[model samples]
Target: MPSGPWKNLSADFCGPLPTGEYLFVVIDEYSRFPVVEIVKSTSANETIPIVDKLISIFGLPKVIKTDNGSPFNSHAFKEFAENTGFHHRRITPRWPKTNSQAESFNKPMMKAVLAARIERRNWQQEPFKFFRQYRGTPHPSTGFAPFSLLFNRETRTKLPQVPTYKPNAVDECARQNDEVAKRKMKQNATFNNSPNDIHCGDVVLMKNEQKNNKLAPNLDPKPYNVVAKKGGMVTVSSTSGMEKNVTRNTSCFKRIPNTLAPGSVEPEVAEGEELILERKDEQVPISDSKSMPMQNAAPTLAPETIPKSKPTVQFSDKRTTPASNVTEPYITRSGRIVRKPAVF
Candidate 1:
């Protein structure tokens, strides 16, 4: 947990708005003090400067949390993190709640923008106004205004108030209240109690984060094989070579039945080929010459096939006739008659 404001920070992008601008929001994890920047793009080049400006104001944060977005996952962002001397912690893919601070702030910021859009006011100006109001107001979790927590002083807002002496118990009170709120939140979330059932070697389906249509299913239909598992993190390799291997939280995966064949594609039959279906209960005798493959058939085997050596000598097709004194003949499951020889 973050011990104080600016120790830990979280960031996320809000949009490509009507004006084709994106709101790049960064918030101090402890104080919930947000710094909003209207970026032309969410590229690492654009975002890194904004983050550097914030660092200039608040000093470098120990850790910066973000989602597995392209900007954050890029090599440039990685180099930026190394150069800036801050740990860049990316949250689980497909799970927004992991970066709750930035995600929660995005809601009210969007609502403010929507309000401005409806009222025919400047959308960009309204979100900053909303941020000012949010900073002055008391946060529900910590019971302290974001400005007060960040600066350790009373924030002057539109509402008139007598300037009073700042209390020294602010940090202690915020910590206690934040801990209680977190405990309550944990208790209320039922998923916190659910066990991680996914494991290495399990065949699974990932939660599809990028759905092109509303009709798309929540979980991807393509199967993946769990190549590794470390605590809650799972490394899955796509069974169908279409996608690259991805490492994500176990919650992003749904364990499928082991019977499923990963990346398996059914072979297409050629123009003159016949499709043969076999049943488990039906037994074809090896001695039946008609059931044998054509002598001149291709020697190459399918990937799943296990080759067996041919017999050195072939058996005769001729069968011995049953004696007339034989009592009775036994019938097998496949309706083949078995004649027993008379006892000496």
Candidate 2:
């Protein structure tokens, strides 16, 4: 949880709406309060103004988390972050769970738009009404309304209520509720953890998520060496001597068994030294093989033990014309052209 309201924020672009406008959404990590701006574009210029306006109303946030979209990755956004004195952090590509606050809000926000369209109401105006109700309602995790958590006052709504002013009590209650909710979520999710056998330095094959064909293996054919393991995330480096290094959730990698031990380095062979292979119960030196007698060699298989070879069938040469005066081309019923092999 954030230290205070507006300290940590998550921002995301929702869509090209019915009017072709995108919703720039900003969510407060602590309060879960959202501020959305329907804009013509999601460029850095448009995003900066919406965030700047929000910063003026609420204090400047310490950190703003967003996906690696063009707006967030642009030089203009970087400059804005530097000027505003906030760290602009980006979530992992293709992973939206890192920015859970904004992503979670987007579902309901879109649902409100859809609901409005079905009811024959203005879609644009319906989101503001939805936000009002959402802000006033008590959150499941926090057990306090977003408006109350952010402003330390109860929001006015259609429902009748007695005005209560206890900012300290609200904060304490929200903190306890948040902790309890997080604990329950973690307990339920612990079963999906990475395999215990996977460890640092183990050889692993990553999941092939972008396979082009059904015949492709589920895991990548190329093996990678695990360099680091942190909780559910694993860092792997390419073992094929390529400069590929990636960090992904542990579930993405499949461990290889009966391979080299972790942190164990193979002894390097000296230049011009041939690699030696030793067979069980037979200690033979490959370099000294020429000196060994033929009598010491393993016995050849008995005639009966060897399988008999099939008789070879000879084909007539193409140059040798057929005995009959038939002038038909050689062709199979399936339309395949057939020709007799020429005798050398």
Candidate 3:
């Protein structure tokens, strides 16, 4: 026999600290009937009492499956299960699919919370109100409200209802008709096909290393579109019109149904000096002109002056000399001519 709804809770409220808004969801595996409880916290110590109350109301199931979380693995839970004689099963570490029954309920519950948050914007204080609305609603599959399924009747509410005559016979006939219509609809919608073969105009997904530079050597799936078909090879075109021939085998390309066309794949251009020059006629000098030989103008150097530390002694007593005696000569320190000056 199929299992009942996966029962678990998640914390969805975020605040300066956690608002303690925990989501408790129970889904029927066969009917998908959901019974959710939104509470401030679901600590094992705190949750034990809540679970006890729920079990008291719904009766203990043969088995309960949950993730390997601290609350589920707590000694209190273990002892409670042992005493109650309810089989407790925990999912393997890091494996969420093992507990998919609970995880699947998260999608619609989250959608409800999001919708409520958008409408009210202050959902933290009124989580229970949303939970009540969700629980009281009729499930699509079971054709029974969660409250009705759990309690065997419609729960009382403050809302007004129009007076109507009780016609149980008429209601039963209407339900039968609805069930027949639903069965017919399901039968008509069923499709039989192996999960392969690219359909014409069906946006088939493919992976090409030539398209994705970062893809590893191993044939991990990437995304491309099937543009045209020829025998076993399909002509695949990227958003950029870069076409490639691919095999129909699923090992080569994983087909993703109902995906939006990917954005254009821009061709990767290599950036280099040659490319830059091609784009713009701008030249950058590699070396300075001084480093290379210049065709014109000699390079000039200035004279260097030497400095003497000692002062020269003056031996001559007479200070003045006649113009005729002041001949153009090179005089030594003893006043003797060292050499006659050459005529210009």
Candidate 4:
């Protein structure tokens, strides 16, 4: 049975890679081989031609799967696929498991592309070289190069190798068969975890901690729909309806409830076209009565005058006549003063 993951190329190149930009990728579920093509755009008009060419080269796959993105789910692409008789399967709304093959391929391709751009500063032409190296290298699990698997033959390359004696034919055949069985078992396990098992319209929290941490608090905790689930991961879409891959564990995140303090009042939104306060038109009546002005009356006072003193006795004029006849005061034994008669 041809049951395995396959690459689904979506024509809607709405990313910021520039107008008319596009990315074409190929995936092999069993080998996990991925090939990417960068184009100008993913528009149906532009994509049809590319798809035709790829199909012609790779042959038609049983089912072509993709995310529920616009380009992949566009009416035009659907019509085109119907006409071509190819099954067009879309992954659940926000789920990515339906197209995990292509999505997984993008990771390494993006990393390599980024590294190339960093080293060369001109990465536009580096994809081809990287693709060639990747396809040529032997896969760790398959032990077969993608080029060899796709072409069914080993490509010639000049490389040094130690000469070794050939093993018995039977031994080599057994070894080869054992390797194939191991690869098949791994592929089976991968398909068992297909994302399609997730139910439609499931509410899932997306792991956006990295991107959200860089955003403002008001912009955080983006919600998404669980469009698909595969293994431990789920594909989620933002409220704006963009899909992204997220781990199932992260889909459990819930919006924190808006809470208020027990005694606090929540503010209400004010309504009404315009608010105008009622004001009285009349001016306040003021009393005109005035207290009588203090009169600037002059002070009344009496004039100051000096008092006359009486004259002392004139003893100096009569001193010449009274020198010899002047009476003298005498003190008696009892200490009393007495006046003596003239003794000239």
Candidate 5:
């Protein structure tokens, strides 16, 4: 997670609510400020525009976290990340907790959406109300409204105006927040057995992330023997002597004990080919976002979609060629050479 506002953002598909539509939910990791856009599709094509909308409002993020869903895994998104100069990191399949920040808010948000549906209110209007309440209220963990954390000011709402609260309240809130987090961590530690660091020759079961295929196994049938460990990443090769070697994030695999029955052997795979999604390095040109720099006085603009259009290029300079039939003289910036009357 980034330590500053808008430095790192995580996005995920929210729903097929009553409308059968999805919401593209993006949150600033540092401030917890959320942006939930009602969207028609969750495909790469739809996601790129919504991401661009976020950039235009809050400036560009340095990194984006996403799942291995097709929207984030597409080649087009890889190109978009390269163009924006942001690293795109994908969380492991079946590991929603890795992206807890977004997922935590998502639960409450969906609950709100569902409640709106049950109340028979125009659910379409519920998202804005949720956004206002969520941003205006102080977060228990940070003891600050997400709006204040992100914008350094109170969101102007219908509530009565009041003086700034005391510093003691902020300090006490921080202490309470720390206590809550510690208690939660202690409870999780009771049942959570963090995986011991893996090493070369250790058999591991890789996640089978094949989409649209219900017949696929949850874990790949053949276990792979890790060949190397690089901090939080590992490179592994199949134990059956097949060439289906791959490098994936540490969370994407589970250690497979030898006591289990030997799995069916997998067919040989190409050396450079990959069975799952992995980060790709690419480069492309990108224009800077329209958002003002954070150091400047922030503008009071609501986050919304802005249509993009291809720039129209017009050249005022004209070209001259000596091979042409016409006898026009070349012009210079200083002055077209005053030519003596042609003595034809």
Candidate 6:
């Protein structure tokens, strides 16, 4: 639980409504009061404005918790969180339980939506009523109504008319919340937490959540070496030298038993000064084109066949010939051939 209302808030998207829209739900961790916004598109551009509108009305939260959704993970949202001076906590991928409060809230909210749909009621108006009623009702864990805790006053409702009741003191509610949280933490601590404490150099098979290819397995068959571990995140380098940082809870990585302990045997190094596949001055011909560059292969065009030059045929200017100097064979008036003039 948060120390105060709106200090720690969780947000999520619940959707595919009848209209194919999504509901962006934001809830106060301590008060359990929720604010739902309808969104046509979940893109960062669209989501940031909606969240900004809500945050403007209510003061900024110290920490904003969200799942690894596109809008939440987007650069725009990250920048928004930075500019607004709030810590953004992204829950482990594929593990909604990491943000249990948000996930739990999503269930009841969706159920109510479905029920309202079945009844053919005015669903758009239902969220407001639901939020109002939920705020008024006392929570089982907190033992105080969200409205009373948040506003320090009992919310007016259509219930039976009675005298005004005083709200629970904030300090008293906080103390009670701390105690309940402590109890729950102790209960959860009973479960084994060995996976959470991964050490560097540990070989683990990280979960494969990437679904780009359908044929890929769910978990990596090959083991990866853990290079770094920071809180719930670990940086693992695969056997093929690819490295990735993944959430500890989301990956659910398991250790692979090693036959040989690390550093027990010195890794093999090339004994000679030269590497096995090192390039040499001497070029040895090989049958395969890949092994060698095919130096002896036939050239595209043979040297002899390649014509060095063509015979030059220089011609006098054909246009300079005088038409008058040219002799013309002509038919005479009586069909006799005409000849060059004797005087010429």
**Whose lDDT is greatest here?**
1
Model 1: CA > 4 A from native: 166-344
Model 3 C-alpha lDDT per residue in residues 1-344, reported as the tens digit of each score: 25443233221112112354676665555434455565566668766776677678666666667777677879989999899877877768887777665686677656655776679766544556755776677766667666666545576667775554355887899999999999988677554424457755555555444544554454324456676766556666554456565555443565655544454343444432121111134322222233322334322211221112222233388454333322332324432223233222
Using all chains and alpha carbons, the TM-scores for the candidates as numbered come to 0.48, 0.48, 0.37, 0.41, 0.47, 0.47
Clash counts per candidate, in order, are 0, 0, 2, 11, 0, 0
Q: After superposing candidate 4 on the true structure, give the runs of residues whose Cα lies further than 4 Å from its correct spot.
A: 1-15, 18-20, 158-344
RMSD of each: 23.0, 25.7, 29.2, 34.7, 37.7, 31.3
Provide the lowest-lDDT 10-residue window in model 3: 299-308
| lDDT tens readout by residue for model 1, 28-68 | 98999999989999888998899989999889999999999
Q: Weakest 10 consecutive residues, lDDT, candidate 2?
A: 298-307
Lowest lDDT 10-residue stretch of candidate 4: 298-307
**Model 6, runs deviating above 4 Å:** 161-344
Q: Write the per-residue lDDT of candidate 6 for residues 102-169, one digit (tens) a residue.
A: 77888878877877888997777776767787889999989989888877778888877676765469
> What is the Cα-based TM-score of model 4?
0.41
Which regions in candidate 2 have their CA more than 4 angstroms from the true location? 166-344
Per-residue lDDT of candidate 5, residues 1-344 (tens digit): 46788898888898876667998889888889999888888888989988987898789888899888988889999999999888999999999998888899998888787888889887778768888999999988888889988987788889798867555787899999999999999789656957566777778888887745877678877678899998778998877676877999888888866666276443554554423211133121112233322343332222221213322323466543223232323223442222223221
Q: What would the TM-score be for candidate 2 when compared with the true structure?
A: 0.48
Q: Give each model's whole-structure lDDT.
A: 0.80, 0.79, 0.55, 0.55, 0.75, 0.72
* Per-residue C-alpha lDDT of model 2 across residues 1-344, encoded as one tens digit per residue: 98898899999999987778998899999999999888999888888888889999998999999999998999999998999899999999999999999999999999999999999999889889999999999999899999999988899888898977655886899999999999989887776664467898789888998889989889877778899989888999987668768999888988886354344464554554533433344222333333322433432222342325422334566353323332322434443333344333
What's the true lDDT of residue 20 in model 3?
44
Worst window of 10 by summed lDDT in candidate 6: 275-284
